[model samples]
Target chain A: MRASVHRAVEELLSEQPAEEVTLPLIATRAGVHPTTVYRRWGSLADLLSEVASSRFSGDIVVPDTGDVREDLERWATAVATDLADPDTLAIMRAALGAGPDGGCACTADRHAQLEAILERERSRGGRTPSVEEASDGLLGPLYYRALFTQLPVTAEWVRGLVRKLLS
Target chain B: MRASVHRAVEELLSEQPAEEVTLPLIATRAGVHPTTVYRRWGSLADLLSEVASSRFSGDIVVPDTGDVREDLERWATAVATDLADPDTLAIMRAALGAGPDGGCACTADRHAQLEAILERERSRGGRTPSVEEASDGLLGPLYYRALFTQLPVTAEWVRGLVRKLLS
Candidate 1:
C-alpha cells in the first residue's frame, strides 16, 4: 500500500509540480483511501520526506584510493549528477519548502554521507572540515548553481570547485 | 497603483506563504480589479519577482578602505542580514521556483551587484573571479546556510568565508 502511494506520487511529480500533488490526488491515483494516507503520512511534508528518504537514503560508496581530493571529486560529481536530475531536484525543493527542521530525510542522509567521508579524512590525518563547513563549501555551490544560476553544473565545474575548496 | 499592488503583495506575504498569495487575493487586498493585476504582472512569478526587485535591488555599497577583505565582509554580512528576513526569503523561493531563466529581476540585480564588487577587486590587482564563480563561492554558501542549515549567518561567519575566498 505504501509502495502504491509512493509510485503514485512519483507519477504525479513527473506529470506535475510538487506543490500540485495533493493527498486526495495521491489517494485517487494509488487506489488507497484518503484516510489511510492521512493516518500514515499525516501531512504532505511528511509524505514527501518519506518518498525522498526511500529514494535518496543509502551509504555513500567512496573510493578508498587514499587521495582525499580524488575521492571527494568522485563523491561530489556523483551527488551533483543526482541533484541535476529533474525529479531529484523537485523532491529536494519540496523538502526545502518544508523548512530546515522539517526532517528532510534526503538531506539528512546526504549529511550522513558527508560525515562519513570527513571521518575517513580525519582518520587519515588529513585536514577534515566540520560537516557543516564541508557541506556549505562543496554541496552548497552545486545546489546554488543548480537552483539559482543558469550555468550548468558540469563535471568540469565540479572539478574546479573541488580544487578551490581543497586549495 | 503600482505601489498599492506592491503593498498588497507585501501584506499578503507577511500573512501567508508565497504560494498562497494568488492574484485575486492581492486584488482583494489592494481593492483593485483582478484583471488589472493579470494585465500588469501576467503571472505570480512576475509579480513576486517585481516585489523582490523593489525590495532587494540596489547598488551594493561596500566600503572602499582599500581593503578587499573588510569590504567583502561588510557586503556579505549585509546580504546575509537581508536574506535572513522571512519575506525576502519567500520572494526568493518564489523566484527560484520560477526556474533559473525565469528573469527574476532581484536575482539579476544581485548578480550585477556582485559583478560590480568583483570589478573593483580587479582594479585593485586582486584575484577577481568571474561573477558566477564568485557568487557560487561566496554568496552561495551564505544563501545556502541561511536557507538550508540552522546555522545563523553571523558577521564572524561572513568574515571567515571572505578570508577563505581571498586566501
Candidate 2:
C-alpha cells in the first residue's frame, strides 16, 4: 500500500509541477484512502520527502578509487545526471519545499557519503575539504545551473568543475 | 494603476507563496478590476515576470575597476544579499517558472552587464572565461548555495569563490 502511494506520487509529479499535486488526487491514483496516506505521511511534503529519500538511496553510488579528484568527478557526474532528469528535478523541488527537516534523512546520507570520501583523501595525504566546503564548491554550482539557468550540466562541464576544484 | 497592481502583487507574494497568488486576489488588494490586470499582463506568470524584471533592473549593480575578481565579488555579494531576502526569493521562483522568454528582459540585462565586465577584463589582457563558463563557475554556485543549502552566502564565502575562480 505504501509502495502504491509512493508510485502514484512519483507519477503525478512527473506529469505536472509539484505545486499542482494534491493529497486527494494522489489517493485516487494510488487506489488507497486519503486517510491512509494522511495517517502514514501526515502531509504531501512529508510523503514527497520520503519518496525522495527512497529514490536517492537507491540511485546514488559514491565511487572511491583512492584518487579524490576522479572519485569526486564520478560522484558529481552522477548527481548532475540525476538532477537533470525532469522526474528527479520535480522530486527535488517537492523535497526542498518540505522544510529543512523534511529532507533531513536524504541530505544526511549524502553528507555522510561525502565525508567518507573526503576522509579517504585525507588519509592519502590529499588536502580534504570540509563537507560544507565540498558542498559549496562542487554540488552548489551543479545544482544552481541545473535549477536556475536552464543550462545543461554536461559531462565536460562537470569535468571542468572537478579540475578547477582539485587545482 | 500599474504601480498599484505591482505593489499589490508584491504584498501578496510576501504574505504567501507565489503559487497561491491569484489575479483576482491581487486585483482586490490593488482595488482594481481583475480585467485590468488580465488585460495588462495576460497571466499570473507574465505579471510575475514583469515584476521580477523591474525589481532586478533597479537592484543589480555590476562593478568594474580593472580587477575581475573584485568586480565579480561585489556583484555576487549584492546578488547574495538580494537572494537572501524572502520576498526576492518568492519573486525569483515565480519568474523562473515563467520560462526563459518570460523573464527575458531581466536575464538579458544581467547577461549584458556580465559581458561588459568580462569585455573590460579582456581589454586589460586578462584571461576572460566564456559568459556561460563564468555563469556556471561563479554565479551558479553562489545562487545554488543560497537557495538550497540554508547556508548563508557570506561576504567571506563570496570572496573565497571569486579568488578560486580567478586563480
Candidate 3:
C-alpha cells in the first residue's frame, strides 16, 4: 500500500508541478482513501520527502573504483545527469520545501553516501576532501546551476569540478 | 505604489512564511487595490520575484576592495549573514519557486556582481578564478549549506572556501 501510494505521487508529479499535487488527488490515483495517506504520512510535504529520499537512495549509487577521483567524477556525473531531468528537479524542490528540522532526508542520505566514498579513499591511502569541501565544490554547484541558473550541467563542467577538487 | 507593494511583500514575509503570503494580502498591506496588484504584476509568483529581486539588489552590496580574495570573502560572509535571517531564506525560496524562464532576477543580479568582481581582479593583473570556478567553489556551497543542509555558514567555512579558490 505504501509503495503504491508513493508510486502514485511520482506519477502525479511527472504529470504536473509539485505545487498542484494534493493529497486527495494522490489518494484517488492510488485507489486508497485519502485518510489512509494522511494517517500514514501526515502531509504531502512529509510524503514527498519520503518518496524523494527513497528515490535518491536507489537512483544515485555511490561509485568505488579504487581511485577516489574517478569515483567522485563518476558519482558527480551521475548526479548531474539525474538532476537534469524535470521530474528529479521537481522532487528536489518538493524535498527542499519541507525543510525538516533535522535537515532533509535526501541530503542526509547523500551525505552518508559521500562519507562512505571518502572513508574508502582514506582506507586506501588517498587524500580525500572533507565532506564539506566535496559538498561545496562539487554537489552544491550542480544544484545551484540546476535550480538557480539556466546553465546546463555539461560534461566539461562536471569534469572540471572533480579535477579542481582533486587538484 | 510599486515600491510600497514590494515593501509590503517583504514586511509580510518577515511576519510569516512565503507560502501564506498572497497577492491580495500584499495589496491590503500596501494600501493598493487587489486589481491594481493583479493588473501590474499578473500573479503572486511574479510579484514575489520582483519583490525578491528588489530586496536582493539593495541587501547584498558587492565589495570592491581591489583585492579579489578579500573582496570575495567579505561578500560571501555578508551573504552568509543575510541568508542566516529567516526572511532572506524565505525570499530565496520564493524566488526559486517561480523558476523564471530567463532565470531569476536576483541570481542574475548576483552573477553580474560576481562578474564585476572578477573583471576588477583581471584588470588589476591579479589572478582570479573564473566565474564558473568561483560559483562552484564559493557561492554554490554557501547557498547549499544554507538551503539544503543543517550546516551553519560559519566564518571558518567561508574563509576556507576563499583560500581554496584562490590557491
Candidate 4:
C-alpha cells in the first residue's frame, strides 16, 4: 500500500495535471478505498509527505577511512550516482518544486533530514565546523548545484573539495 | 501569437493536460483565434518547445576575471540564481516530465545548449580538463548540489570553492 501510494504520486507529478492531487485521486490511483488511504495517512499532504520522505530518507552511509579526502570523494560519488538517477532526482525536483506557495512540511522535513546527516559528518572529526555558516562553507555550493544545474559531477571535484576542507 | 501559445501551454502545465494546451485554450486565455496560435508556431509543441527554451536557456555566464577563483565564483553564483528561479527550472522539469516520449526536442536542445556553454568554458584556459568529466576539478558537485538540494546557497561555500579553484 505504501509503495503503491508512492508510485501514484510519482506518476501524478510527472504527468501534466489532469486533476489536482488529493485524497480521492490517490485513493483511486492506488485502487484502495478512500477510508483506507485516510486511515493510513490522514490527509493528502500527509500521505504525499511521508511517501516522499521514505523514498530517499534512509541511512547516512558515511565512510571514515581516516582520509578526509577519500571519505569525502566516496560520499560524493555515491551521492552523485543517486542524484543522477532520474527517478530519484525527479522526485526531489517535485518536492523542491515552486518553493511551497503556502508551506510544505515534507520539503522542510526532508531538508532538516539532509542537514542532520551533514551535521553528523561535520561533527565527526575533531575539527568540526563551529557554526551553521561554517557548515555552509562545506555544503552550500554542492546543494545549490545539485538542485539547479545540468552539470555532471566529476570525481575530481569531490576529491578537490575534500582536500580543501582538510587544508 | 507565439507568446500567446506559450502562455497557454504554461497554463496547461500548471493545472491541466498539455492536450489542453491547444488553440482553443490560447483563444480563451488570450482572447485570440486558435489559428493565431497555429499561425505563429505551427503547433502546440513548437510553441512550447520554443518558449521552454527561451525561458530556461542561457549561456553559462562564464567570467574572465583573470583570477580563476573570482571568475568561478561569479559563474557559480549566476547558476545558483538561475536554478533558484521557479519559472525557468519548472520548464525544464516539465520537459523532463514527458520522459522518453516522442518528440522531446525541448529536453535535448536545452541539454545541448548547456553542454555547449560548458564546453566553451573548458577551452578558455588552454589547460583542458577531461571533456568527459564535469569541469573545474570539483565544480560538478557545486552545480549538482545547487540544482538538486534546493537549499539556500551561502557566500562562504562560494568563496571556498573559488579559493580551491584559484589555489
Candidate 5:
C-alpha cells in the first residue's frame, strides 16, 4: 500500500506542481483510499521527500576509462540530459514548490549528492584544482548549455572542452 | 501614470506564488481604474511584459581594470547577487509563471529578447565567442547555486568561484 501510494505521488511530482497535487487525486490514481495515504505520509511534504530521495539518490555513477576528461564529459552529459527532460524538471519544481516556503527543502540533500560526486572526481587521476585554467571541464559546459540554451551536451563539445581544460 | 503602474506591477511580481494579482487589484494599488489599466496594456501578458522588461534590463557592466580576472570576479558576483535576491527570484519565477510557457503565453518575443541578450554579451568586452568558456563563466555557478541550494549567493562565494575560473 505504501509503495503504491509512493508511486502515485511520484507520478504527480513528475508532472504537477505541488499546489496542484492533492491526496484524493493520488488515492484515485493509485486506487487506494485517500485516508490511507494521509494516514501513512502525514502530508505531501513527507511524501514528496520520499519521491525525491528515490529519484536523485546522489549515487550518480561516474565511469573511469583511464581518462579523467572522458569520465567527466560522460557524467556531465547525463546530468544535462536529466535536466532537459520534462519529467525531471517537473519533479524538481514540484519538490521545491514555489519560493522560500521551499527554502532548505530538497536542496541540501541534492548538494550533498553533488558534493559527494565532485569529491569523487577530485580524487581520481590526482588532478588538483587548476586556477590558471579558464573553467571546470565536463559538468560546467554541460550544465551551462542545458540551463541557458537548447543545445545538447554533445560528445564533440564535451571532448573539445575537456581537452582544452586538461591541456 | 505609467511610472506608477509599473511600480504596482513590480510589487505584484514579487508576491508569493499562491497570491493572485488580478488587473483590478493592480489598478487599486496604482490608483487607476481597471479599464484604464487594460486600455494601455491590452492584456495581462502585455502588462506583465512591460513590467518585466523594465525590471530585467541593464548589463552586468563588466569593468575593465585591464585585468580580465578582476572583471570576471566582478561580473560573477553581480550575477550571484542578482540570483540570490529574494524579490528578484520571485519576479523571475513569476515572470516565467510555471512550465514551458517560457515566461509569456507567446514566446517569440521572449526568445528574441533572450537571444539578443546572449549575443550582446558575447560581443561585449570586445571579446569573441568562446561559447563554452563564456557559458561556464556566466552561468555555471549561478545555476549550480540556484537550482541546488538555498544558500544566499555571497560575494565571497562568487569571488571564490570567479577567482578559481578566472585566475
Candidate 6:
C-alpha cells in the first residue's frame, strides 16, 4: 500500500505540478482513502518532504577510485545528470520548497557522501578540501545552478568545479 | 493602497511563516477586500512572488573599490548580512518557493551586478573570471550555505570564497 501510494505520487508529480498533487488526488490514484493519507503523512508538505528525503537518502553511491579528484568529478557529474531529468528536478523543487524550514534535510545525505570521499582522500595521503569546503565549492555551485539559475549544469562544468576545488 | 498591501505582506512575513500568510489575512491587514487582492495579484502565490521579487529587485548596491576581489567580497558580505536577518530569510524562502518555476527572477538583479563588476575588472586590464564563473563560485556557494545548510554564512567564510574565486 505504501509502495503504491509512493508510486502514485511519483506518477502524479511527473505528470503535473506539485501544487496540484493534492491528498485527494493522491489517495484516489493510490486506491486509498484520503483519511489514510492524512493520518499517515499529516500534510502534503510533510508527504513531499518525506518522499524527497527518502529518495535522496543514502542512495548516492560514493565513488572510491583511489583518486579523490576523479571520484568527486564522477560523483558531481552523476548528480548533474540526475538533476537534468525533469522528474528529478520536479522532486528537488518540491523538496526545497516544502515545509516551514525549507525542507533541506536531504542535504545531509550529500554531505555524508562528501565526508566519505574526503575521508578516503585523507587516508590516501592526499591533500583535500574540508567537507565544508567541498560542499561550498562543489555541491553548492552544482545545486545553485540547477535550482536557482537557468544555466545548464553540464558534466564539463561539474568537472571544472572539482578541478577548482582541488586546485 | 499597493504600498499598504506590500507593507502588510512584509509585516506578516516578518511576524510568521510564509505558509501562514493567507490572502484573506493579507487583505484584512491591508484594509483591502479579498476580491481586490485576488483581482490584483490573482492568488496567494502570485501575491507572495510579486512581493518577494519586488523586495529583492535592484535594491542590492553592488560594491566597487577598484579591486575586483575586494569589490566581490564586500558585495557578497553585504548579501550575507542581508540574508542573516530573519525577515529577509523569510522573504527569500517565500520567493524561492513561490511560482511554478520557483520564483527566481530576482537572480537577474544579482547577475547584472556581477556582470558590472566583471566588466570593470576587464576594463582595468585585470584578468577576471567570466560572469558565469563568478556566479558558480561566489553567488552559488554564498546562497547555497545561506538557504540549504544549517551552517551560518559568516562574513569570514564569504570573504574566503572571494579569495578562492580570485586564486
Report the lDDT tens digits of candidate 3 across residue range A1-167: 98999899888878864445688999999999999989998876678778877887756778979888888888889988988888777666656544442135557777787889999999988788899888888878987888777877888889888888888
- Please provide, for model 1 over B106-131, each residue's C-alpha lDDT reduced to its tens digit, 9 standing for 90 to 100: 56777877777778888988886688
Task: Report residue B9 deviation for candidate 1 (angstroms).
Answer: 3.3
Q: Which ten residues in a row have the lowest lDDT in candidate 5 chain B?
A: B101-110
Q: How would you class the docking of model 2?
A: acceptable
TM-score of 6: 0.89
TM-score of 2: 0.83
Best by DockQ: 6
Ranking by lDDT: 6, 3, 1, 2, 5, 4
Q: Local distance difference test, per candidate?
A: 0.73, 0.73, 0.78, 0.51, 0.56, 0.79
Task: Report how far off residue A34 is in candidate 1 (Å).
Answer: 3.7
Q: Judged by lDDT, which candidate is best?
A: 6
Docking class of 5: acceptable
| Candidate 5 residue runs with Cα over 4 Å from true position | A9-24, A32-50, A64-67, A100-125, A130-144, A160-167, B1-54, B59-71, B93-97, B101-132, B150-152, B160-167
CAPRI class of candidate 3: acceptable
TM-score of chain B of 2: 0.88
Docking class of 4: incorrect
lDDT of 3 by residue, B1-167 (tens): 99899889778877864445677888999999999999998876677667777777756778988788889999889978987888777667656544442135657777778888899989988788889788877778887788788787889989998898888
Question: lDDT of model 4 at residue A68?
Answer: 47
lDDT of 3 at A33: 96
lDDT tens per residue, model 2, A1-167: 98998899889988865545778899999999989888988776677778877877747788978789889988889888887787776666566544443335345566677788899898888797788778767777776666556566778988888887777
DockQ of 2: 0.32
lDDT winner, 4 or 6? 6
lDDT of 5 by residue, A63-151 (tens): 55655555556655566667677676555554543444332344444345444444566777465344212233444445445434555
Instruction: Please identify model 1 stretches exceeding 4 Å from their true place.
Output: A17-19, A38-42, A98-106, B17-19, B38-42, B59-62, B98-106
Candidate 6 per-residue C-alpha lDDT over A1-167 given as tens digits, one digit per residue, 9 for 90 to 100: 78888788788888875555677999999999999999998777687777777777776688889888889998888777876777876766655555544447657788888899899888989888999999999988888787777787777888899989989
